[model samples]
Every structure is written in C-alpha cells, then in structure tokens.
Target: MPAPASAPAPAPPSPHPLRTRPFRLLFAGRTLSLLGDAAIPAALALAVQEATGSTAALALVLACSMVPKLLLLPLGGVMGDRFDARTIALAMDLVRCVTQLVVGVQLLGGTPSLAVIASVEVIGGAAGAFATPTAAPLVRGTVPEAGLQRANAAMAVAHSASRVGGPALAGALIFTVGPGWAFVLDAASFAVSAALLCAVRIARVERPAPGARPSVLTDLREGWREVRTRDWYWSSLIGHSAWNGAAAVLMTLGPGIAVHRLGGGAAWVALLQTGAIGLLLGSLVADRVSPRRPVLTANIGLATYALPLLLLAAGAPAVVVIGAYGLAQAGLGFLTPVWETAVQRAVPEHALARVTSYDWLLSFAAMPLGYALAPLAASTWGPGVPLTVAALVVAACCLGSALLPGVRRFTGGPDPVAPAGAEAVSLPGTR
Candidate 1:
C-alpha cells in the first residue's frame, strides 16, 4: 500500500491560568468578594423593607447605592488605569468592610433610621464604584491572555456558587436572627478577601510618559470615542442597558413579590438559587463552547434576558417563575464571557480600564431610572404590569441590536482557526 500521509502534528495545549499562583490568589480573593456582594443586596433589601414598610423607601435606599456607583464608575475606571489596580481593589474592600461592619452593629442594636441605612449604603456604593472597575483589568493582569475565557468562566462559577449560597443563607439569617448577622458576615467576607489580596502581589505597573499622560477629561473623551465609533460595541451597550434597567425594576420589586405575592423569603431564595444554578451551568457551556460566532451567539441569546420578567408578569406559579428566571439567567450567562473576552482583546491594554468604565457607566445609566420608576409604577399599576413592560423593553433593545449593522459581525478576542472549508470559530477552547 502507498505510504499514508503523515498525520498532522497535534496542536499544543493552551495555557491554564488557574495553575499560576497569582491567578489562583486573585481567584480566591475575588470569590470571597463575590460572596459578600451577593449577600449584601438581599440582606439590605430585607432590612430596609422591614425598617420602612414602603416599597418606595426600599427603592430609595437601593437607588442611593446605585446612583453613586453609576456616576463614579468612569472615575473609578480612570483610577484603575492610573494606580495599582490591586492596591485600589484592596483599599476599596477595606472601606466596604468597615462601613458594613458599622451598619451591621447598628442593626444588631435595633432597626436603625431609614436615613442612616441609606447613608451607609451610599458609602458602600462609592467603594463599589472603584472596586467594580478594577476587576476586569486585574483579571487581565493576573491571567494569561490565552486563558482569558477560562479565567472568566472560572470566576463566573465562583460568582454563581456564591450567589447560590449567599442569598439563601442571608435570607435564612434574616428569618432566624436578623439582617444584622448577614451584614456582619458580608463584612467578614470582605476582610478575608482583602487579606488574601494583600499577601499576593504583582509587579508595579510602569508609569506613562509625561508627554503621553492624558487629563481625566481627555481619557474620558478618548474612551467615549472608542465606544461611540463602534456600531457593535455601542449597540451592545444599549441592549444591555435595557436589560439592566429591567433587572433594576426586578431588584426593586422582587423582594416585595416574594414576601407578599408568592409566599415569603424562602421562595425568594429559591428563585435566586435556581437562577444561580442556571448561571453556573451556562458558564460551563461558555467555557466549553466558545461559540463560533461569539457576537452572534451572545446577542441572540440576550434577547431572552427578559423572559423571566415576562413570566412573572403573567403571575405564573412559583415553579414557573423560577424556571423562567433560570432559563433567562442561562442565556445571559452565555453572553457574559464572550462579550468580556471581546472587550479585553479588542481594547488596547492601556485604555482597557477606561473603556471598561465607559461600558459600565453606560450599562448602568438606565438602572437608576428603572429603580426610581419601579416603586411609583408599583404603587399605581402594580409590579406585574411594569415588569411586563420592562420585559418588552429588554426584548426590543436586545433583539434590535442583533439586527444592527455590526452587532452580530464584530467578534473580538482570540479568534479561532478552523480547517479549510470549516466555519470560523470564536476560540479554540470552545467545542
């Protein structure tokens, strides 16, 4: 028989970032951070609702937290780029730890004034503004470029796992003891996170040349330019903004729904738990599938972001609502890694934080508005009607983006290569 053609050499295995010490430390710290974060909202919501019997008051408290973060996010991004991101993250956590500890102590004494709680939330929100922007840049710093998708997926797993435990545990604590203990737990979690980060260090970032340094205004201007000039990027932001707004409404109204409409805290926790499980599964899918056309896959999946809201609007049974929310979260999970990988790869490393800040600022722009509107609408039309409206809004924005010029065409990050005649893929990690 004729000599068989030599088999093609096997492709080299890609780097696994979690194996590296720095990345492991970063991951552990961030995992702890997310646990605290996930606990805060549910605990805060219950505490505020109990202290003040009005949904509007609850909305105001949450809005106070969100508005500052929204306004300060761009500045936070600038800080992330200019300073040591790790240092900034650590400092922010310490600030959050102290503030939360104080708030929890007060709550332990008695139901504090609504004003006092809101003020504390404001401080926590400010710290969050700086902390949130640092996360992406910090991840980029710790993990290898080739393993960005895996790192992100791993963090998503951490996030989902934390959410699964945090909210339910917080709810149970609120039921048994009080919201105070939940807050204390979160404070402890932040302190732990800070300790982990302090021990793990990275090389100092080089300073920009004196001539090359841009004013904050110039950095903001440049970041905006990058976003607005890109059809896909801007459209994606707009789409996500709508979904965010819808989610804001849910955050404002969901607790009330669980407490009064559905059953109580346990039901709320179940809803969150189901969604968390779906998010976990979907993130695993992202790590495995790295969809061939990431933009297309992400945007297409995003249209489902509002499905749970729609189900809730219909006054579905608890199981039905939870199931829909889980499905929606999974769809959202599919988009998260792809979009993040795209941004990390496409944006210049030097400007990544600023660009990320702009993205966050824009994404959060509509949230406060939705939050402000939710209570008012709930008072007038009830939560279901407004939730239904929010769902439609999400659909309009996301589906509309998919129809945009470049929303489905622009796929960034590590582009995947395929054999001749095979369709293009997003990355090699994807199946």
Candidate 2:
C-alpha cells in the first residue's frame, strides 16, 4: 500500500511593525472616539440631573449604558474572531454617531422625556458592545512582536488623553452652549473617527477551520475553558476584576462624598481628574524608561494607587487630595501599557479576542453592581468608611494578584520572528 499522506504543516506567522500606516490610522481613530466617549458621560449625567433632580435616576441612566456592554462583551468577542473587525468598528461608529445626534437634537429642542434619553443611551451602549471587542484584536495585527510594547504604550497615552480632555471639554461646552452642544460635539467626533477608519485598509489573516457550530452557552464555556488553561490569564483577570470593582465604588461615590461631605463639587472632581491627567503624561514616557519589565513595573504601580485613597480617608485638604490622586493616576497610567502588552504577548492570536472579551467582561461585571452598592454602602457604613474599604480591597487584590506564580514569573520577553512552517493567527474585525 502507498504511504499515507502526510498532514500539512502549519504556516508561519508574518512579521509586521508597530509603526505601520494602518495602525497609526486606527490609533488616531480610537483616540478621537474615546475623547467623544468621555464627553458624553459627563454631559449626559448633568442633563439627567438637571431634568430629574434625582441622583438615583441619573445612576440608572449610567447603569443602562454599562449593562449592555457587560452582558454582550463575550458575544462581541466571538463576533470579532468570526468576522472582519474593521467593518464592525466602522458600523459601530456610524451607529453611535446617529445615536448621539438624536440625543443632541432631543436635548437642544427643550428637554425630551427621561424615557427617551434612557432608551437612546441603552441603544448606544449596545453598539459599544460591538465596537470594543472588535478593536481589541487590532493592536496585535498592526504591530510586530518587538513593537507590541511601544504600540500599547502609545495607545495608553491616547486613552489617557481622552480621559483627561473629555470631561474638561464637556464641562466647558455645557457651561457655554448647553449640554446639547456637547452631545453635538461628541457626534461630530465619532463621525470623524468613522471616516478615518473607513480610509484605512487592514489585511486579513486566516482563521482556524470550524468544526461544529457551538451554542452560545457552549461558546461561553469554551472561552472559559481557554482561560482556565492559561496561568497568566486567570491571574490577570482576577487582578483586574478586583481593581475595577473597587474603582467602580470609588468613582461612583467618591465624587459625591467630596462634594456633599467634603464641601467640594465640580471643581474638586476636576482637580482629581487633573491628577489622573498627570498619570497619562507619565504613561507616555513609560515605554522609554522600562521597555522589558512591564509586568513587574505595573505591579509596583498598582500598589501606589492605595496611597491616595488612604490619604483622602484621613480628610486631607483639597490640594493634598488632588496631589495624592494625581500620583495614583500617574502610577496607573504607567501600568496600562505594560499590562496590555503582557496580555497581547501571552495569548494566542486565534484566541485573543475571546480572551480579551472575557477579561473585559469579568473586570466590568462588578461596575454596575458597585455603582448600585456605593450609595447603599455609604448609607450603611458612613461616607468615608465605604471609600476606605474599597481602597483597601483594591490594594489587597493588587498585592494578591502580583503574588500569583504566573503573574510574578511570566515574562513575555520579545518574541522571536516566526520560523517557516508556523501557523499565523488572525485578529478579529475592528468593528
């Protein structure tokens, strides 16, 4: 009998650079989109408060915006892996533009019904669920192995810039032309982002052959299974989950405490946010200072975040509080690039979107719940007590995660170029 046919060997992955044209365009688009995102939340919160005079109701509006993303994040990841990310991203941007435009019109034409505003926010959030996961895999596609760190660093800086500028700009717009103008500005920003994405052409790669189409439950199970099998994956997920949970509480309740209890309002919030801006500047310089030991550096930074909260708990004056907050944010900013690069290098490309989605889902799962609990916790335990506890919990999680064997030892050093016969993995669509 003739010899059995040999199985085909896997193909090698391609080499690419972080500074490629497509990546640059995508990065620019993301920065623009984030800036808009920042503006909308602040403007929306103010609008709701002005119309209803109910903090609880405004909280509900915010909850509606986040719930869809939290619920659909995993499914969104699957879609990214199954389709072209660029197409998904562009479509999502257009949808958001329309949603924001509608919102802008409603606000400009005298206040619309609260129901209408809430409905629009939920719709926009649904669109965001599609946009976020699609964008996760794009970084892997645009940059080469050696350049992943730099690419992630650049992205972190851009994200920080949006966070820093978005609210400030929104406040200014709201003060000058009303909330309607802020929403309009946000809509225009999304439009510009969509056009930029449309102008770029991303090369698609091959995907794994499908065996059987899995049910949604099965798909989720498979994703979980994949995560369970990786050491760094679980450690990173747990760490981020704890961090985000604590952050959710502080972000939701801290401002209120500062305003009502501490006799500081929007100005205090702005001061704290400005501190976070300083962190962004630090993150921009992180790549140049610590290119290789990102994980270790990030772990150290995570520890520092606790300091600010601890100081705030002690009733520090406004200047001291702002300085502490800035220090914490600067540390976090430096950590973001390192953490992103670690994840990109650790996970296989085929599974990257699924893993990222899972990461996001787990991390953000507690956010809405935290928001709900913050007020209750304050009522039960007193204002400063909840903030103190939340900060402590965050510190503990950071320390605990860093102590994990995988996280402590995992050094995704510069990966070598793929040799011949290696299989290349495809990144999910940008949509």
Candidate 3:
C-alpha cells in the first residue's frame, strides 16, 4: 500500500495576542473607549455642579448614567451570545457617539436644566449597558488559551494608560476650553473607537436557524444554571458586589472632598488619575508572573484597597491620598488580568458573556445605592463618616472573600488543578 501522507504539523503557536491583527485593532478600540470613559466622570460632575449648583442634581445625573447600565446589562449579555459581539459593540458606540455629540452641543450652547442633562445621560447609559457585556466575550475569543493572561495584561496596560492620561486631559480641557469641549472630544473618541472596532474580527458560535433559536428565557436560565453550578463564581460575585457598594463612595464624594476640603481643583483630577500608575505597574508584573492559584493570589492582594479611603477620611494631604490610591488600585490592577483569565478558562466559551452579565449585574447592583446614600450620610455625619464606612466595608469584603473555600484553590484553566509539581493549596474543605 502507498504510504499514507502524514498530517501536517499544527501551525506554530503565536507568541502573543498583540501579534494578531484582530487583537491589535481591538486593543486600539478599547484604549480609545476607556479614554472617553475616564474623562466622562470628571466632565459630567463639573458640568452638573456648574449648571444646577445642587449636589442632589449631580447625584441624579450620575445615577441616570449608572441605573440604565445596571438595568440593561443582562440583555446586553444575551445580545453578545446571540449575535456578533463586534457588531453589537460597534452599533452601541455609534449611538453613544451621537448622544455625546448632541450633549456637547447643548453644554456649549448654554447650561441646560438638570432634567435635560439627566435625560441625556439616561440614553447614554443605556447604550453603555448593552456594550459592556460584549467586552468579555470578545476578549475571551480573541487569542489562544495560553495567551489569555498576556492578552488581558495588554488590555490592562492600555486601560491604565488611558486612566492616567484621560483625567489629565479632561481636567485641562475642562479648566481651559470648558466642559463643552470635553464632551465633544469624548464623542470624537467614541467615533474613533467604533471605527477601530468595526475593523477587528472575532469568531462566534453560530446560533441555530432563526426558527430553531433558543428563546431569551431559555438562554437566561441556562446562564443562571451555569452560575449556580460554580460555587467559586457565585461567591466571588457576592464579594465583588459588597466591595462595589463601598467603592462607590469614592465616586460620590471623592472629588468634592478633594475640592472642598483638600484645596483641590483640576489638580484633584490629576492626583486621582495618577493612581492608575499602580495599575500600569501591576500589569507589567502580570506580564511576567504566573500564579498557581490565581484567584487566591488575587484575593490576598486586593485586600489593601481599603487604604485610600482610610487615609482620605483621616484628612491626608493630596500627595498622601494619591499614594494610597495608587497602592489600592495596584492590587485591583493585578487582580484584573488574572481574574479575567481564570474566568475565561473556567467557563465554556459560548456561555461566558451571559455569565459575565450576571457578574456585572451583581457587582454593580449596589453602586447606585451607594451613590444615593453616601452623600446623604456625608451630609448628616460629615463626609469623613462615609469615607470611613467605605474603608471598613472594603476591608471586610476583601478579607472575607479570601476565606471562601473554593477561592483558595482556584488555579484557573481547563483542569482547574494545581500546576505540575505544586501540591494543592489548603482551603477550608481541601482533602
């Protein structure tokens, strides 16, 4: 018999996700989008305060952005799974671009009523909700499994850079050209991001024929089932949700404290922003370091985020507060890439977006309450009281989350086992 031809050897593995054209474009898109995201908070806060002179109005405007995002996050996940993530992302960015452009025009023309600004934010936030659930799915699909850590690190690096630069730019523009130009620039950024996203491609699991496609309820339930089966996942969500509730105090009151108490203006924005330098430092570390128990490592490290609130509540100087924020955010930065890679590795690819939506929902659900309550609490007991409470909440959640049985041994990959030659790390229920 004629010799059977050998199967061609598998193509050599890619060294990194950055080497791939699609991932590179996606990276660019994300970098641009985050810049706009980072800038929006400062701009909106300033504009609302300037127009209404009412702190309640500012909170309502912020709430408008957040509430819709929380409400629509789940449906966004469904869309991510059922359709093209790239297309969903691109369409949402287009809508956001237009919304911001119109708002920018209005802000430039005159100080609109609180109602008008809040209404504009409502539309913008809704678009954000739909857009967010697609992000993890796209990232999960972008690179080979082995490259996930590096891919996430790269994205984090970009995000960190944006955080540092975005706020600086926002403060400058807001201080000089006025808040109006900041909105215009943010709108332009979304357009650029959408264009970049449109160029990047991601592979998707094709749905059944139109007549045979699963109902939305069925899809949601399947996603819910997946969440239920994983104790580590659900527990982590609970921990994150608690932490988010506390974290919101920073957004709700941090800037005001910096301005009113700490002798801050635009410098407040820059100081807060400089915290992302720690994130960049953490990403640099992640690129070189591999964790045997990624979730455990993340848990142990993230407990330090309580420091900034503690220091700020104690009335630390701007430089000191900035240092604490840097330290805290570094822990978060280190957790970001590892946690993401771990989850992507653990979940079946097709259902990741839906599960991610659940993650987003649980994590963010309490933030609006935090925003609503923090200012009121501050008003009653002084701003320091809320900051103190936030510090305590963050410390409790981080330490408690680290103690969960499933979290300690979560190594993150197909087998979910300790790395070769490493013994299993002890947990409450370990053998």
Q: Which candidate leads the pack in lDDT?
A: 3
**Candidates ranked by TM-score:** 2, 3, 1
Q: Which structure among the candidates has the greatest TM-score?
A: 2
Candidate 1 — number of clashing residue pairs? Answer: 0
lDDT of 2 by residue, 128-244 (tens): 887887765777776766677778788888888888788788889898998888888878888988998887776565664566555667656766766776565576666677667
**lDDT for every model?**
0.79, 0.74, 0.79
> Which runs of model 1 end up more than 4 angstroms from their true locations?
1-8, 45-57, 109-116, 175-178, 201-207, 210-212, 250-270, 312-320, 374-385, 414-431
Candidate RMSDs in Å, in order, are 5.8, 7.7, 7.2
- The candidate with the higher TM-score, 2 or 3, is 2
Q: What TM-score, computed on C-alpha atoms, does each candidate reach?
A: 0.83, 0.85, 0.84
Deviation of model 1 at 180, angstroms: 3.1
For model 3, the stretches where C-alpha displacement exceeds 4 angstroms are 1-13, 111-116, 250-271, 311-322, 375-389, 415-431
> Which run of 10 residues does model 1 get worst, by summed lDDT?
418-427
In candidate 1, residue 174 scores what lDDT?
Answer: 85
For model 3, state the Cα shift of residue 244 in Å. Answer: 1.8
lDDT of 3 by residue, 159-241 (tens): 88887888788889999988888889888888998999878767655465778878898888877877776667777776677
Q: Candidate 2: lDDT over CA atoms? A: 0.74
Local lDDT at 261 for model 3? 70
